[model samples]
Target: MSKKSTIQVEKVNAHIVNWLKTYAENAKVNGFVVGISGGVDSAVTSTLCAQTGLPTLCVEMPIHQAPSQVNRGREHIEQLMTRFSNVTTIEADLTAVFENFKSIVPTVPDLDKVNLSLANTRARLRMTTLYYFAGIHGLLVAGTGNKVEDFGVGFYTKYGDGGVDLSPIADLMKSDVYALGEYLQIPASILQASPTDGLFGDDRTDEDQLGASYDELEWAMLEEEQGKSADDFAGREKIVFEIYKKLNASNQHKMREIPVCFVSNDIK
Candidate 1:
């Protein structure tokens, strides 16, 4: 399985915890705040932040979220608080807030566009909520994105889940994050659950949306990094490689820094 880590799990855990602690200390922030999505990434990120021995706030901002997601998030937060004194939690139910926003916005003819916009809206709402807590509590917002989502596929929402003060696991792949989750003793309910953003208020999973499994995407990412292309593969491998390339190219805007319109002094 690609889940196996190339490095020592114990040392990686210690290194991340130390890195988080030093970053918080240097920034003069109290600790870290993470948006708990009932997924392995958030569960692992929160656990790592708790290990920093500084304040770790897990905020649940649900907008018509699934009960399973909610339950898993609560379970992880409860376990975290029990295991670490610095860990804390808050539930900011955003169902009503989301409904209000939808009602106020102008309706459009394109249902597909509206649905996609609202799904992203759900993520942005959660992002706003996390920053709110971070602002009032003097904490840094720790991101839960892994390498596959953050860079390989650009699966995250722009300025939404992607808008974070720091990313503890952005360098780790999806499989690597699961490996750390195992080391961190993350709750089995979360560790075993299918990965989802839960933004659509339904049971659809990340794979259903992405059209390929994380393992396949990981293989494609590595292959592309090693200078392979879709033309080199056949059958399912070709399909998955094409999917990865399409998403990687389309979502480059999300993965890269915002483009600035530069004007020379002469032009100005």
Candidate 2:
């Protein structure tokens, strides 16, 4: 991390926790509901929610989840319960739900297409499950997206992982999330674990789908944010920039609110 980019983990944590308390108080919600994915983003976000002293429900809804993924998520939740009296953990395995959907949904002609659709369905299903729990408890659904994935490349599924009542860390950079995670005393195993969306039958990291690691994508995104020209990059850096641009363009829709039809008064 750059000296200028260094995060004041204490201050940031306080700010986010206060924000959550204020928002939940204003919204008159009971607590927060977050999908615990075993990634640093979720770990940090859930911890921040817990720090608010409100009831924070951490839901682990695994759909055919890998052992490592499940283990990390459970450990994080256990850590949270150990530290915070307000933290509650729930395990809702949706493997059967996903299988039933596969069995019932009309089969697409292509296998790859089917797999992709199912992956997204997994995300939406998890979102649905979270909201179901949240609605009954009068809690707001807290999202775990970071700045790079949420905005830079628009890497989240629309109304799926992207669906939320609040995004506490949507503004934090991926690298800085790690810094804050360390400050929050998140488990080293989770902090060091490879990040995944846990949406596929075969495990694939986010970088595997995005075509560039978070570090390279963040650098390219920073260059764009700083108004640095892509022409300045040479060789591999240029290639990464192109990849970044393509992803940013392709997933731009996910970064925005739902589009509504407009009819101008002049037109009428």
lDDT of 1 by residue, 1-268 (tens): 1435575789999999999999999999999999998999999999999999999999988888889999999999999999999998888999999999999999799998999999999999889999999999999999999999999999999989999999999999888988889988999999899999898888999999999999889889999999999899999999999999999999999987889999999978
Our model 2 lands, by Cα RMSD against the true structure, at 1.8
Q: Residue 232's C-alpha lDDT in candidate 2?
A: 81
Clashing pairs in 1: none
| lDDT for 177 (candidate 1) | 89
lDDT of 2: 0.90
**Top-scoring candidate (TM-score):** 1
Off by over 4 Å in 2: 1-5, 265-268
